[model samples]
Each structure stands twice: as C-alpha cells, then as structure tokens.
Target: MAPQLDTQTLGLVFQSRPDILAGIQQAADTPARTTLFNDIASFVYERLACADAPDGPASKRRRLDIAQPPAQTHRNGHAQDSVPPAGSQTGALGADAAVADPVLLEVKDISVTAPQRKKYDLCFTKNFLYARASGTSVPVQGIVYPWTDIEHAFYLPVPDKSQAQYNYVLLPRGSFLPTAKQASASAVDRQQPLEPLVFTVPATAPKPGSIGGSSAKTAEAVSDTYSSLFNWALTTSLRSAGNHSCQLVAADPKLFHSVARQPHRPNEKAVHVKAFRGSKDGFLFFLPTGILWAFKKPLLFLPLDRIVAVSYTNVLRTTFNMVVELDTEGSSDGSSTVEKEVEFGMIDQGDYQGIDDTYVRRHGLADRSMAEQRKAKRELVENAKKAPADGEGDASAAGGADGMTELERAQQEAEQRLQDEEDEMEEDYDPGSDGDSEGEGESSEDEDDDDDEDEEDEDEMGTAED
Candidate 1:
C-alpha cells in the first residue's frame, strides 16, 4: 500500500516545488484546484512509500532495465552477483547515454523574447522541437512541436516594450484546426493542431551605461533612414496609381522591427532595431491591391499572390502581432536562403478581425461572413432536429387546420390580444368621439358662467340693502 501523507506535509512539498502547480495550470484541460491538489498529494504519497520500501531502489533499477554485473562462483560453489558501481557505463547510464538518443540540437539558457519574454530550454530531436521552462525538469510543462508546423524563425525588435526588444519567434505555417462544433459536424480524422505558438529567444546586446551603449544612437540613425525609405516607397507606389483605387483597410503609424543575420558568414552578427523609425515607429497599410508597409524602409506593393501565409501572435490581451511570410526565390546553394517573413507589431486589437478578413479573402480562404452564416444555419437546423414534431394533442390545442408548433400558436394568440387591445383603445379615443367631449365641455362652461352671474346679482342686492 502507498504511504499516507498528512495535509501539512503535502503543503510543504507543494511550497518547495511550485513548478508542480505551474504544470497543472499550463494544462490545456486543467482540473479543479482541489482535484489537482489531491492528485499531487496522492502522487507524493506513492513516491514516498516507494522510497521507504527495502527493495524499492532495486525494483526501480530493474524497471529501468539497468544491467546487473555477472554472477561469480565462490569456493563453496555458491553464485553471488555484484552490485554495479555508481554512474557506471552500463545500459542507458553514464554521461554518454544521451548521445544514443535521436536528439540533434539542444540549447539551454534561451528565452522566448517576443510578445513576452519567457525562459525556455529547447531541444530539437527527430523532427520535433521540445520546449520546457528553464531550470525545471518537469515533463508536464514541456511542449513538442513538429518541424513541419514551424513556418519561420526570425528576429524582430519593437520599441517601448522591453519584452519585444531583441526578439526572435517561430510562427506556424498553416491555419488552425476546425473548431469543436465544426469537428463534430464533419467527420474529422485528425486531432486539433496546437494554436500558433511563438518560440522566441533574445539577441545579445550591450549592457546599459557601457561604451557600446552608444549603439542605441546608431540604432536610432538606422531607424530614421528606414523611415525615410518607407515614406518614399509609399509615395512612389501611390503615385504609380494616380487614382485612389487602393482602399486602405488598416494603418499603423509605429509598428515593426527589422533584423538581418548571416550565421555562416564570419562577420555577420544579428541586428535588432526598430523597423522604420528610431522608436520602432512605422506604418502598415492594407490596400485593396495588396498589403503595404514601411519602417526603416517601405515594403511597397506586396501583392497578395506573393504571400504564402499570415499568422498572428497574441500580445498580453492588448494587441496581436502579425507575421506575413512571403514566397521568394532561394539562394543558389539553397541552404543559404532565408525564409522571408515580416513582423508587424503593436497592431490595434480592433483591426485584427478586419485584417484577418482581408487576408482570408485575398488568400482564397472561406469568407468570414459566409462562415458565420453557415454556422448560424447549422445551429438552426440542429434546433429544428431537436424540436419535437407536432403531435395530435398539439394540433388539437392549436385549433387550426394549418399545422403550427406551440410557439407559433402562442405568437398568434399574442397578436390577437394586442389587436383587440388596440381596437378598444382606438374606439375609446376616436377623433369623431372627441367632438362630443368638446360639446359637453362647452355646455358645462356655459352653465358655470350663468351660476357666476346669479352670484353677482345676489351680492349687488345685499350691498343695496346695506
């Protein structure tokens, strides 16, 4: 039986390892807090019991398939087995054990630095990128993303936000899976894919107040040059089309970051700076012809046909950052080619829907309004199916040869009541009826005038007698 742990001991364990709680919270379908606590308590109890057992360690080693040393024959002809030394190079043990695994690249001390900065240790193995919070070995918080789902990895820097500075993110290459309702309606063969996840790592930068701190000013100069270029591009594109044919869908004055890096080249270092202006200020215009944006320089006339995909990163409930991947030619070696992606940061929350709508329309995706209509129609059809057919009793209660549901009958009754009330009110306050009321009012006024005259005569007679 598992050892029993008291509440106090369980609380202490939880306090010592807060990552357990964090793991529970990160679950996609998180249980109630009380249930999670109870589960953790039970787990701790079982672990403690296992540790306390006499043969627990040996059993664990056996379960892990740890190899035992060969048995030796003693002078008495009795066989005895020797225990393996600690950290022995036997059966999945020792320093080189991980080498046998399929993991290709593993990097620690990395932080995701876009939308938000989060420390994560990344491991790439067998076409899957596994990520876990830095400094914690908990597998529950680890996420596995397939390489095919990853669209691109690039650097983007935004001003006025610390987390956005020196940021690199991996965006998803495809659209999200069908919603729960949609999946139920259709025969979905596959499970839902994960939402667009942005894995970010920060770039190296000079410390504040250091000699290299002047790089900030240099970044500013670069931003100004880009901004000027952007303005020129916008003017040039608009000039080519003399008529204002391009309808503006959305515009952002200050948004975007540009970074260029060539790892194979010796002198190539990652550059992270505001995109258009020194302050990361730039404009993004969604035009009918396509999308246009400028920051340090303008990316003018990016035709929709050239765009491969558009993805978004939610930024702390305030905004969404857009990532646009373009289909471009590869370098001669092909290996040296970069995946062309543009990041538009700090977009207004309200404009997200419109931008997404425009993207879907341009990319031949289902129309947003049409999708909504279909969803509503499906709901109506489902409700109709769930509703009962008119029974004999229901038809009799309706008292009409035309078949009607309870709701229709109720509506007809309500309309009849309303009509009757309106007719009564109209008769009570008819224009022709108002004339009789006016004549009666005049006769009453005349009678009142005669009464006044009589009272005056009585008063005059009394005065004469005095």
Candidate 2:
C-alpha cells in the first residue's frame, strides 16, 4: 500500500519539492495522491541517501557540481554557493562516486506536460539519466533510466504552441517501473507502454539582463543535457549491437521533404505534420532517425530497423491514415518473432505525396506484403523437389494411391469393381444370340400343335365307346 500523506509527510514533500504543493492541493482523492508521490519516491530516496553520507555537504556539493553545465556554473559562481570548483575529493562519496560516474549535465525545472502534468529536474550522468521532482533542495525519490535503455530521443515542436519545443525520450514497452500497489487479483494487466519522458525549453531566451534568467538558463541547460545523452549513447552497447543512438531528432527537410508554415508564423517554414492517435490529436515528425509522435501521452517512436512496412489506410480525398507495421520481441512460448502495428489517422491528404516520396519510399518501407507471397512460392518449389519417387507421380501428387487417405482409397476401390462388372456384361452380349432366341420360340409352337392333335383323337374314341 502507498504511504499516507499526513501533515508531516506533506511538509517533508513540500520541503523536497515545493512545486508539487500545488499538485497536492489539486488532487481531490487518495488515488491521486498515491500516484503523485509514487512518481517521485525514487528520487526522494536517492536524495536522502546522498544527504545521510558521512562526509557531509562537501561530498554532496561535489556530486552536484559535476552535473552543472559550464555556462550555468560560471553564471551562478560556484565559489559563493559550493566548495571551490578546483580539484575536489569526489571519491569519498563511495563506489559509484562522481569521480567514476561523473554527472555530464543537469537541467532543473523542465516542464513535463504529457503522461502527467508536473515539472522534473533532469540529471544526466555518465551511465544513467535521472528525472526527479523539481524545486527540491536535495535530490530524493525519482526514476532512473540507464543510457542503454533509451532507444531514442526526439526534440520536436509542440502543436498550437509555435514558440516552444519539447524533448521526448522513447523506451521499450514495459520497461517503466510498475506503480500498482495491489496483488495480481485486483491489479489490471493491460498494456502499459513506457510513456515517453517529455520536457520543453523556453520559446525565447529571457529579456536582456533579466533577473536570474532561469528560463533562458533552462533552455541552455536542456541543450547541454541532450548533448550529454547523445555522447553517452554513442558509446553504449546498443551502438555496437544495432547502431541505435539517443541523438536528439529535429526537423530536417532532407529527411522529410514536406515543410509547412505554422498559422502564427506564416513566413517561417517548419516540419509539423498533424495526425491523430485514437481521439487524441498530436503531430508526427519524420526525422532521419525515424518517425516520432509527440506532445501527447503514449508517445510513439518507430525506428527504421524495427519498421517492416508502411501503408496508407482509410484514404480519402481530404485525409488519410498511416499504418506502420513494426517488429516486436516475440513471446517466450517459442515464438521467435512477432509483428505489431500502429495507425495514425486523420492526416491531411495534402501532405500524403510529400510523405510517400520523401520518407516511405526513401526508406523502402512501402507495402511489402508481396514479400510473404514470394516466400510461400519458394516453399512450394522446395516441396516439389522432395516429391515421392515412383511412376505413379500424378497419383502421389494428388494424394491418391500410395498417399490416398483411408476413406478416399475405399471409395476408389468400390468404383473400380463396378466398372469391371459393366465391362464383363458388355463382352458377353453377342449378335448371334438373337438367332438362338428365334429357334427356341419355333420349337415351342411345334409342341403346342402336337398336343392339340392328341386331344382331338381322344374325343373321337370316347364317342365310339358311348
């Protein structure tokens, strides 16, 4: 069961992340509070662990310093807030200390609007990416994603919000931590796709000489964070296994030819193809890496290697839908491969030609159902080569004679016997047999005449005797 959020607990939570206080107040039920806390518990625990370290604030500051980008570090002047930026003992923090697992970059107060509406402070380390609740004085409960676990990261524009851009990270299905508190009987086992982690940067940098410039600083911080993740992904084991990298994907005309202007920014062209998944509306981005559906919950990223085919569905004069067939890690019950499909509907027909010519054809992802037919034909050829070795080739091929089923063979034998009896009857019928029938009729007539003469004589003798 989830922990109760009493006054003391709420105080600690607010102390950890003051921004969440508004969310807590907005939450009207117990389930909402449970979900809210569960989201940040991991981050909170990690923060508490670091704070309780025996070496004190010096060790913690060393760890945090590694995460700050160079620009942010200079602007804030670490000399005033933390220990000297010079050589420090990051090793005392223990086995996986900052020395070995140095933080590459960290961005605080990134606005996440999808999957859940909350703000997260993103920290990218050498081996992992961490997202903890924002506004926390000390890092605490948060989720961590290993560098290898991330399939790809996309930096895409938000629909209707022309000025803002958001970053989306895609992971494999079911890789996220489960939040269910009940047993299997009551727990729902429905699909739980790893909702992409979304965060955005300020549309424009802060006004010149603005106080703190937190928004502009966050924008730069987001850039540094993406760079750090990309560099780490380039060296991860996945790079060698399949060449998948976590680089940030943005609009490129070479990757997708169609570029249109937003309603608000008529002069500036952008690659923001609109589409829908179910009833929810979102935008589709065609990047050099793959296709990304963004600024919505259940964001989907389909990479080139996993894509089997792309087809247009529900096509109409004004609109069409794209169905993308993907390869999945098959079931454990001895099935080695499986296919899954996702359909993005209600796309404008005007963009169809551009999408078909640019991405689908270039990637060779167009309809490939004929490939299966060709495979079936090849199997037939192989079976023909292994046919039975006998003069009764046709019979064997038809599953007759040697290969005939029990019921079929019985029916064939019965038909053959009837044919033989008919042949015998035809052979026995001769033209001379008609003469023999005529002779037998003439003999019968002669015997009848003799019997009539004897009856007449017997009648004369009986008259004389009387």
Candidate 3:
C-alpha cells in the first residue's frame, strides 16, 4: 500500500503538478494568485526540511506543527489553519526563519506626484528598483545605479496647497563615474554616457511658497547688517567710492589668501596673499546683478544666477570663512558640469554670516528687482503713449481758431524751419543772386581782357610772318 501522505506533503505534491501550477499562473487577481504561489512555496520548504531530518520523519513533521492554527482570530471569527504564507511572519525562532524574513522599505499602490510631471508609484527592494503608474501594472520601468551613486536630496514646497509638498532627489549625471571602470565590465558599452535621474517623493503636509522660510528671514536680517557695515567700510577706506547705477547692497573688507592647485601637476601648490584695507587691496562688492571681488589686480565677477549656494565656516573660533558655490562654464576636460566652491578667509564671524545671508537673499531677489524695473518702464512707456501731446489740451480748448492739433502745429513749425534752411542753401549756391553775381561779373571781365590780349598778339605774329 502507498504511504499515507500528510496535508503538507499533499501541498508540495500539488505544487509539483504542472496543471495546478498553470492554473495558479492563470488566476485573474494578482493578490489571490500570489498567495497561492506563496502557500505552495511554504509547503515545499517544509516538506524538504522533513526529508533531511536528523530524527525520524514523524519527529521532524511534529516540529513543524503544521496541524496547529494561528493564535489570532480574524474579524470574521475564523482561525488561519495553514502555515503562514511566504513573506509573512510565522512567529518561529530559528536561523532558517530569520533568513526568510522580509523588510518593507516602501509601500506599493501609493502615488507620488511631482512638479510639472506625471505621478508614479515607485517600489524598491534590496535587489531591484522599479516604478509603475499608480493603478496600472501594464508597463514597469527599472533604474540602474551604482552602490555609491551620489544624490542631492532636498524638499521642494508647492504653491498654495500646504500639504502638497515634495522631496526631490537629484541624481546628477556621472555621479557614478568613479565606479564606472567596475561597472563597464558588465555594461555593453564602456564609454556610454549616463543621464541624470530625478526622483520625487510626495509629502503630506502644508506646502510652502518657497524654500528656507526661517533662513530667508535670517538672510534678510544679515543682509541689512552687512549693508550698514559696508557703508561704514566705504566711509573709512581710502579707495575711491566709484559711482554705481544701483545702491550699494553689501560689502566685505578683509584679507584673503588664495590657494591655487594645478590639476595637471597635483603636487604643485601656489599661495597668493592679499589684504583689503580699502586702499591698495580693493573691497568686495555685492551688486544687484552679481558679486565682485575688486582687487588691485583683475577683479573676479560671479553672476547672481550662477551662484548655487553660500556656506559659512569658522576655523578654531579665530578665523571665519565664506565659501561660495557657483555653477560655472565647463572646464577644458570633457567631463560633466560641476559646482565650483571659492573660499575667502580671515573675516569676522558676524560679518561672514552676514555676507552669506546677503548672498542667498541677493540671488533670490535677482530676477524680482529686474522684473519690477521692467514693469515700471513698460508702464511709463504706455502712459507716455496714452497722454496728450504738449499743448494738445490748450489747442483743443481753443477750438476752430487754429484748425490743427498740437502735433500738427509742431510738424508745421518743423517744416517751416526746414524750408528756411533750404532757401538759405539755394541762395548761397546761386551764382545769379545779388551777393554772388557781383563777384562772378568781376571774374568774367578779367577773363575777357585776357582773351582780347591773346587775339591781338596772334594778329601781330601773323603780319610779321607775311
């Protein structure tokens, strides 16, 4: 007689049956279908363990407790009688159970809306990362990245809606360049360029209109303080206060030692030291358009828009430094674009903070001021076009007395002036005119006398020859 098969063994046998596996695959609902697959997997694992048992099959099977139900009851008052499905907790304590544990890093079926982009639900695991539309599963996208890929992550606030903010993770292009050599062994093309990636995580709080709310206020305060300090510096300094179009925004007076490094010759280092007392060494200027470091040598100008960030640091509580990060033009090397950080040291700590705040605020306000100025100029031009011409209202009030508008009257006066000029020019060029004719007649008489003398001399010469 065949050995009597237990329920767990029967489950493993069902999984091995091709027809049953095909049926599970063809199931309409994914959740129910996956549950069936998990149940099959759990049963197979238990059956295999029983076969390799140190004790007899009966003892190994008893250890599994396959006949026992879950201690917790369901809302419908039914106990879960089967072994916990794969990817679920069975409350068993062992190395095998621990190895089968799963961690939920993120949830599925949840949509993350991005700025000016479509929504997607992203799922990440230890081995794979994929994204799909919020509800559908027809198309799935995968992301490939190095383990050490660098990312710039920041929170971006949405307008009006308080709870609709987003967290942006910017994966810059070539962030994985350092590990490209290792990745190239597996990649089809070793030299293929990598594109940047942006991932947006939706937030569930009140959205802000702009980033750095408290920081912006602090920046404003610092900027004001720096502006006052600049005025004081300019008054005391011996450097000529050059007239500028815009108001003096901020200034910094301090010494800076520049450390230059040669990329080609890594071992070479050059240090250039200078002092800015406002006389020989020029001071730094923060204008509406850009920031300028004015020195006796050529000045360094960085546009406000090109500036990425400003960071302040204090060294040993003695020296203060301000590092400005700027998005500059590409280098000669055919590498990806990067932000360059320029450091200026030997500044007052308070002044350094002020300068940093001023830099941030200035960059934020760069376009706003220009936009306002443009709008004002446009309004002025429009008003000028709509306003009455000079003396137009008076001329209109005078009615039919002068049958011309102020503009027509001005045109008439202009035409009269032009006519007078032309008449004077014609008179000056006319030979028959009173003043010019007298001078012309005297010259004509002298020419006639010369012709008569020539004719008389020719007659005498002919008579002498006969």
Top-lDDT candidate index: 2
Clashes of 3: 4
How close is each model in CA RMSD to the real structure? Answer: 27.4, 21.7, 26.4
Candidate 3 lDDT for residue 25:
46
| Shift in Å, residue 35, candidate 3 | 35
Candidate with better TM-score, 2 vs 3: 2
How do the candidates rank by lDDT, highest first?
A: 2, 1, 3
Error of 2 at 170 (Å): 4.9
Q: What does candidate 1's lDDT look like per residue over 281-341, in tens digits? A: 6555443334544322212334555566666543323344666666665322122123466
lDDT of 2 by residue, 1-466 (tens): 4333332223322433555755764662675554455345324434544553444776566434432332232223221223221112221122122222344455556665654567766555544455555444333222444444455656555556655554555454343221223435323433222345666656554233321222334344433444343334334423433335445456776567444557865665557688998899988888887787765665666767767787665544356677787766533222222337777898876677577766788878866523553322111111112346565445423432365433455467679999999999999998777766655656777899999999999999999999
lDDT: the better of candidates 2 and 3: 2
Each candidate structure's TM-score, on Cα atoms with residue i matched to residue i, is 0.26, 0.47, 0.23
Against the true structure, candidate 1 reaches a TM-score of 0.26
Index of the highest-TM-score prediction: 2
Task: Report the lDDT of model 3 for residue 458.
Answer: 100
